[model samples]
Target: MTAVLFFLFAAAALAGALGVVLSRNPVHSALWLVLTLLSVAVFFLLQSAQLVAAVQVIVYAGAIVVLFLFVIMLLGVDREETLSDPIKLQRPAAIVLGVLMLGEVLVLAGHEWATGAQTAHGVPIHGLMDTGTDPGNNIERVARVLFTDFLWPFQLTAALLVVAVIGAIVLARRSGERPEDPGPGIPAAERARPGSGSGERPEADAETSEGTS
Candidate 1:
């Protein structure tokens, strides 16, 4: 039954991941991302890692996806842009990198993969699987290994996130600046104010005799 559930969620995760890439609508892509994240949390649950699963659901699915949706909506979902690729060799580079990543997955699949031991950078819920005495054993053990063993990498990730946030704020400050032309749909009075000389807008009344009269 465990294997059955695992395969089911694994399929769902893969489908959701594909949907995220293939879906044209940003909102639909974000919903697909939520499914992928939830499936990953289920993977942790299958390993009896409740804390890690909760964090995955809460942090990635809840917070990160919400932020993504917020940004998508704020940028105006109705707006469309040209689908042309702006960067050179982008498609080829993506294909190459994707193939390399697939090769890595196949390599790992051939190896004997197990939990309850330290992963490449992060440790699993070994404490939970080993001892039933302590309720917070999983939390304590994982936190200790993460802080001591993978502290530098964690710090680097945090610094990168901080830098991204700062860059977003700087860009947001420029959103208010727009073109001076209102682009149609304005009252005649607002467009042409009284007591203003024709020199203020030579283009507006170029053929009229108001200024010449």
Candidate 2:
């Protein structure tokens, strides 16, 4: 059952990753990323790392992906008129790369799962719940190392993420706001129609029509 689940989620993770790369729409790519993150969280669960799985879902899928979507919406890129592949031999190249990636994954699967697998503190994290005395060992260990040893690096990464968000805002501001564009609730055609802005204008026009009649 474990093996079956592992393969299933591994396939899903691969598919999600491909979608993230192949998707032209930024929002679609972000949603694909969420699939990949969820698949990874499942892997952590299989490894008996509940806290890691929870963080993987909450921090990465929840917070980070939300931030990405927010930034993408703020950028507000216009959609392409055509979806055809513009580059020559793009499809062929993608197929070749995909086959190579599949071969690599197969090769890695043949080897022991322990090969090059370790936590940030170089501790092996294969089966924490199965081996550890306390059920909360994973959380305790992670918090200790994260706060004591890797705190500075963690804080730096967070600061960089904030900087990236601010940079996106700055870029959006440079593009300038399109105040002329109608709000989401209002139809653009309705906003542009003559005498739509003021109720008094319509009433005055009706009075003039009556007088002329």
Q: lDDT per residue, candidate 2, 48-85, as tens digits? A: 87898998899999999997887677658524436777
Top-scoring candidate (lDDT):
2
Each candidate's number of clashing pairs is 0, 0
Misplaced by over 4 Å in model 1 are 78-101, 108-136, 147-164, 179-213
Cα shift from native, residue 99, model 1 (Å):
4.9
Candidate 1: global Cα-lDDT?
0.70
Which parts of model 2 have CA positions greater than 4 angstroms off? 18-30, 68-83, 101-128, 131-136, 174-213
Instruction: Please report the candidate that would top TM-score against the real structure.
Output: 1
Report, for every candidate in turn, its global Cα lDDT versus the true structure. Answer: 0.70, 0.70
The clash number for model 2 is 0
Clashing pairs for model 1 are none
